[model samples]
Target chain A: MIKLKANGRERVWFYAFLSPWIIGFLAFTIVPMLTSVYYSFYKIHVFNMNVVEPTFVGFKNFKYIFEDRLFLKSIGNTFTYAIIRVPVGIIVSLLVAVLLNRKMPGTKLFRTLIYLPAMIPIVGSTIVWRQLFSNDFSLLNFLIGNIGLGPVKWSSYDNAMGSVLLMSIWCGIGPSMIILLAALQNVPVSQMEAAELDGANAVQKFFHIVVPMLSPTLFYLLITGIIGALQAYAEMSLLQMPGDSTTTMTMVVVQNMYRMDGYGIGYSSAMSWFIFFVVGLITVVFFRVTNKFVYYEG
Target chain B: MLKTENKQKRALPLVRTKKTRKLIGDIVCFAVALILSCILIIPFLWMLICSVQPESSLIFMNPPVWPDPIRLVNYKEVFFEIEMPLLFKNTMIIVVSNMVIGIAASISVAYAFARNRTREKNIFFSVLLATMMLPWVVTLVPQYIIYNKINWLGTMLPLIAPSIGGSAFFIFMFRQFLMAIPKDLDEAALIDGCGRLGILIRILLPQCMPIIATMIIFSFNGSWSDYVGPSIYLTDPDQYTLSIGLSKYLVANSVTPWHRVMAGCVLFSLPMIVVIFTCQKAFTRGIVASGLKV
Candidate 1:
């Protein structure tokens, strides 16, 4: 190896460049991650908003998760939402991308409209959806009344989960749509043209050429979607009202921490790790499946 | 000559048939896309109406398709009655501070990772990617404990410090952008007696304004919408950002009047929507460019 003339000085600047993240990780992320592992064994109480030195309970917190009814329900809710939302979100977004792929009039306008909702802050969108799903006074009720259907209590047991699922689908489709649109554009026009010349119809061309080319993007979105859906805390927390019949989410931790005035910080920490594990497992599964099918155009 | 004539003769009818088929396809695609886009955008349309209408007009058996007598009172109330101005200032303080640090740190480390070939580089890079998979929620309690021991709780330190450490995601993004740049530029800068820092500050940064802009936008949006961090750390009413403030508005108005609460939410979310619409081209480009590597 050739020695650089400015080797000593270069090292100083390199360390300087690296310090922010290094310092940050040591101070913030790594410290917190390790601390949380410790906290998973302790019981915490919020006395006057000051956390008392957590009582070391050992594996009690982990055991609580298995025993608690709400804890088990939350796990089921999280997985069910992910399983339902991920594939549906992917399929809808992919379909939208395919529709927007062609050079039709006002296509750009439609694309913009499609992507607009992804920009709205989660809390903001949830508030709007709340009003739309209001039992006594909702635009949905009005629309349904016109068709002679009874007004539905959207947040009730019969519909609450489905309503949230629909909202999830609406909010997520935009980003995936844009990604798929880009992927579609990257597909070779020559290949499509050659297929047409060989007397392949539109469906044949799409199924054989477009779908294969779009798989990598589909896979990427699928993994990220799973990760995102697993972390579905914000909308659920916001949508939930006091005394509401619905309960589906990671928001139970936040709700317990904030509203219940009971601080089982250790139990919450255990729950959080469980969510992380599920997400990690899903991500691994996605990688395994996608490795077989995703066509790397690059 | 016969081949050319036969091709032309066949192409003429095919062109006519193709146009007819394409038109039908366009109509079908347009209708489908229009309906889906409407589904996606309905929340936003409702939000705009919620912000402008009177609290009374907002709550009806059948919500009005259009706001009647268009009460512009909510915006006034949000500014005067609610301490939204203070909330905006608080959010800006956190956003600006972190944006500066995140960009500086991410760009520098990204440059190092992109150009340098140290022995530990691969190990460090994989570790960085691995960290991305660790959900923030898992770290929440532990980080809180650490912060508690250090007595940094109830301050913005908990919120801002992690960002200064180059975010794995942003670092990855910047590295990818830097990789796209020609290496000759760095070599030329080095030949002219520019040190790595000098090259980073002088030559490379100037060429990376688009990416810098992208980083700033995402950082701003992230900080702006971030409720979980500040909420966990800052329990003081004065310390709350817009996100926490919006949530509080809902909780407080759970029974009082949802119209006013929605109005506040609409006002709170306006910045995000406006930013997105204006900079969507850059937004999509930035995300796509960053995601290409992942």
Candidate 2:
């Protein structure tokens, strides 16, 4: 035991302070995580599990997930959404943050308003979006209609995923923008002035200086954004109707475990593990690929 | 000639005055931000407009921003659809319990990290942080099984009690804030016969009010906005938090009442807006701190 020479009881106080978290982590997080792994390899029926013993069916649940058309479609939808949503979120939020960073008169109030979407509950914002996107009375279509385009069927199979993406971007970017704006403050003002002195235009200064300086923040947003994107649940889950094509991976796991006639505990556990692995993989890949671009102010 | 040459060198190669250029910049920035912000705020304005519009206007066509004789009958319907007082009570229970346990334990865990130097603690802290990245879906079913096994499925305990373990994100934030405070402050308190808990409470906590306030707001809003947790555990309508209640209100029937749903949404978002307006500074500070690596 690599024990420090603390007065013998100091360690006692330390552990005592840690006990609540320790207890919680064990029972709630760590135990469940371990048990989920165990459950994934076993054919554990949902309601009759206490009555019926679970059989050890190694890799069977994994086999089911890969073969299940719904699972395949849902995972595909989630990644497709992430690929588009993550970049759009980053770019749009960065643009807004730059606009706010312009520090014009009353920009602060506008910043608050811009962030208001994030402050509102997702369900609330989504319900409002549902109304706005309702084909019968779509405000979006009305606005587009003025531009000589016809009404968009926002909830159609073709547009359902896009509708959710539109709402997600609106809500998601506010926080990212705030974070990026904070990072913007740290992007050396002296460098910007020098760039200006070098006769660099706005676009040149942004790409050359601001983007590089903000890469760390951008990278952080990317990883978290992808993580969040995979779990795009509430909006998609709420607005989901018959023939709605936006069932995300999180929704798949949720329904598989919770809904009636679900694949039961074993299958959902495998799916959860699959999600865990993917999240871990994406995070690892990001760290590996984007590390060189991230400038740490040493 | 030399002075003019120096002035020309410092000045921009432009015909316009600096003041005019700055004014132009300000207008351009504001115009762009204003247009985009207004675009973003449309949903909110739509939310507000729809909440007050009569059901007649909402059903047939897009509700106008100002309905002819604005009505608040939908807010009244939210009253009958769900017990607002009881709903708030149920939510407050989750919020208060989680905050009390989550904050205190987070502080204790953070205190240990900040003050207690141990080789194991560093690894422990890293493990703790790794948990934050562990998505809730991984634990959802097993935790649900555990809760069900213990017959806690229909109660708020599932939502509230897990937080007894200090949340990894908050603990990490608190630990960072604590580490920045000089070691000598707590050491001086120790010399003055203060106990560990006393030193933590009297010396450390007051200095961390901004972070603490931030946690309060975050935890409060988190509970308020939590749809998944409430939907999963609290199966009974009587026990439903505002999120579940509002969702049910929206989707309870085939013909969704747009006005009442918006009203419920407005009600759902009210406390959050108030919390933000009150603690906006603290939240921003916490977020800025959060983005930095510890």
Candidate 3:
């Protein structure tokens, strides 16, 4: 870090340049964070415009959340969704990236086609997915029928979460593939050549060289992916899968706060804070455990 | 040269077989790529096909691969009956306002972080990056409360006002782009009596057009398609953005025409498709740049 002795004018200009972010940080992030924490310990009731009050509840919300079956079920659903989605998403993306990184014909066109899904808005794409997975008239069921398989009820209570995972993986694979592809391109060609000269097979070379080299990017993706999956709401909302066995934790938060007439604001705040803690803890554990495996090529 | 030639002669068959192996690998890769591309493209193609097909044809067990006669009535209905023009106008207002405010705020702060070399600045930058990992859920309820208290609920202010504060990701992108620029240019401008703001506006901004364009495109895409923010804040039908409007249209009337819904989806996604195609290089470069930084 280079230390520069700035004059009074430059110092003033420096703060001026940073004022917007500072103001935003305070007004948006820090205040909201603190307020959420504070509100979690109280019963916040808002009646119309002028009547609003927050009474101290002191751990009742958290206690209620722990005992709440819906909260527990949502947490379970969210975990199930994340556990299925994240690993499958990573593997699929890595496979696609590897395929695209190869010197193949029409690689650019193929890359663009695969990535185009990520560019579409989630709301619109979810609607398209609902149509595609509709049991009665679905294109998927039609193809499956041609192959002599039974029509799958994709949006049923048993399969709703699975359908959500499938759509998410499809929509999400593009960005992850782009990241992994970029990482794969950065693997030094000379190292691969050296590995080849040592009588290593293609699989051996990929596992020993490419996977390790790509681990840092994979690690980054894993953390972000887990966080994203845990906090997923838009897809669930757009897909209209709410308050069932498939209600995710984030959906529960939204449902309790917004859809439930704002009566459970404190309880919802507690739920949100609980998710924050879990996500934060998972992220920390990931960095601690995976740091050794991530290769930082200098 | 003679010894090398002799070695090469011995290695010729090995190289030939290696070439064959590589050829097989490329073929396999191409096959896989083709399958994956088809999987990705089929949904959008289905949307397009369904949007033009009449409602009677959509109820079959096996959907048609192509629209017969290709009626444009769905789009016409979406425009006239669905009030899509109002949604578009509402969306554009929020998108354009957020883009302008967000870019200005992000660039200035990013410029500050890029040019300054102080311990406190580094700490602030790291805090900003840390905030990126803080899920939006953590702030959702509290922010809603704040907005409700201020009576900005059911208004665009709640959706648009928060953006005036720089977004962490955009700020990071701008900072990274600016850091790649050399400091000597700033020094030269300073010696020529250029002020700090002038150096940013006159020198850095021109060179950083690609990143600025990237920011604009991303902000536009994000604000245009944003559902959660508007859904939470805006309650009035008249104030609904395209995303909310389309979603409500779909959810409110399940028995409504699927063709019209598909038409609305296409219209909602059309601008982004055009932006992606037209600014393909910048778009990919921006994504790749962010990915590489990770």
Candidate 4:
């Protein structure tokens, strides 16, 4: 390896080459992150683009976030959504991964098909899904109708949340499945054979061998999944109707940022920050809990 | 003697049980796999069906799961009504340009991080890693404000220019892939009087095909799907990409037709689908090999 010596002036070129990202991050991401924390304490007016000199209103925004009805509802909605979606998404992917791992005919075609949803842009896919779940003529309602069931108002108040969740799972299954499938491939074939030789049935082998060995990949997926679920706003934005059902808390914050204008901006930032903290905390906790279970062969 | 012979026959069958078990295993696996495949393909099949159906017939009280008479008009309507071709062109420019810039910048920077053992390089690379953990939503407004002030908001500058530095995740990916490559090639090139740039371009670049292909597809897919950036930056309707254009269609009115939206989606997603199918293995391997730490 021909290593370059980091002499006094050579450091300048190194710094220069790295300037694009460093400057951008500091100015855009870092500064904004810090400012958001700062602004969470004060009121912000989107119209004026001023923070109202940040009157030292400590925890008021946070307090309001907890007390507000929509905010509270959103918190409940978000938690329920994440809790259900994360596991379902993981399970669906795992199932797909396992099936694809088998020496079956058309495995290649199945793999390609599984990855199709990820290739579709989020907005476009959401649009497609929205139409499929449309109240008047959704593909879903059509399918349901065939079974002699009433067409559910999928995008309406009660059904809308479920619709969004379904959409998320559909779009998310592909990438997670792809990653898990790759991980499955990395599992040693010898382990399976050894179990078989030891008189282990397929069920016993899966539980005793496959599941334990696959835990690390599973842990990784969980961490990434939580991070993703917390930041999920695309489907909500696309599926949200004019009146109400689509109004999850994240959407509320974004709507405040876009439509509600000014009074709620500070509060919204605080709420989103709370989400960030919660997500980060959940991820750390997951790692802590699953660390013991994660098996590393090497 | 007859009883002894019968006992021997039973023992022989028991000893040959592995072959029977193998046959059962294959049959079971095939049966289970077919069911799983059907579940996975349902959505895509629905999408195909929806894309071809006429708008009027799209939402019947008891609509057919499959299109009875395909309407080619939905595709035509998407092109004419939504100006999908223009959006495709617009998105392609951003996607292609950004991919080139991102790849160039990432390869060089990743090479430095993976191979160059300089103090400054280490710190700089660490900074890059740290940035990846920070959420982009935090900085989105600031970036938009900066771009707006710089008079690059409506143009593709804000969308394209920032990619020249490459993404943190992509940089990390390339670095990992580069790390796995043998260092002796670089040593040999150095002995031949090849400069660092020449070694990178002629030697490293060729061997880095899979990673490069991954980067290209990823960048294309990311930029193509990017809605938030374009929705925020591009105020002009005519400048909308497929993402923004599709969003406009969906959010326009309560009575948006399902068939047209599906057709538009199918049309918009063709590029990515085509690219992914063509380089499926490379894409999967690139992600798995690069993402996992040794």
Query: Interface Cα RMSD per model, in Å?
Result: 5.6, 5.5, 5.5, 5.6
* Pairs in steric clash, model 1: A21-B165, A21-B166, A36-B142
Model 1 fnat value = 0.46
- Cα lDDT tens digits, model 2, B1-294, are 978955764685564445566777899888888888888887787777777877634534653356656878889988777778888888988988998889888989988877885557877875774575555665666677788889998988899889888887678656655654546667877888899999888777765665676577668777888988998889887888888877786677688777777777788878876774565443232332332324
- A1-298 per-residue lDDT for model 2 (tens digits): 3344464567788788888889988878887888878978987655533314678999998888787777777777878888889999999999888887775677667767887777666656655666667666677787678779968888777777787788789887666675566556545556688898998989999999988777766766776676677766666755553354534434444534432333376767777777667766776687579757766443
DockQ of 4: 0.24
Residue-level lDDT of model 4, residues B88-205, one tens digit each, is: 8899899999888877778767776766645768667655644544445655654656666778878988888777677776676566556545576688788899877787888777
Candidate 2 vs candidate 4, lDDT winner: 2
Note the DockQ of each predicted structure: 0.33, 0.32, 0.30, 0.24
> lDDT (CA) for every model shown?
0.68, 0.72, 0.72, 0.68
**Model 1: residues with Cα > 4 Å off, grouped in runs:** A1-23, A104-109, A118-127, A134-138, A147-153, A181-216, A241-261, B1-24, B57-66, B80-93, B96-135, B141-158, B166-220, B231-241, B244-261, B282-294
Better of 3 and 4 by DockQ: 3
Which residue pairs does candidate 4 place in steric collision? Answer: A137-B59
RMSD of 1: 6.5
Q: Which one wins on TM-score? A: 2
Task: Place model 1 in a CAPRI quality band.
Answer: acceptable
Per-residue CA lDDT of model 1 for B176-283, tens digit only, reads 556545467678778888887888877767656645655665677778888778888987788888888877766675365555666776677667555544543432
TM-score of each: 0.74, 0.75, 0.74, 0.72
Ranking of all candidate structures by their DockQ, best first: 1, 2, 3, 4
Calculate model 2's interface RMSD in Å. Answer: 5.5
Docking class of 4: acceptable
Model 3 lDDT per residue over B128-232, tens place = 755665456656766877887888888999878778778887786566456545476688889999998999998777656545655665687788888879988
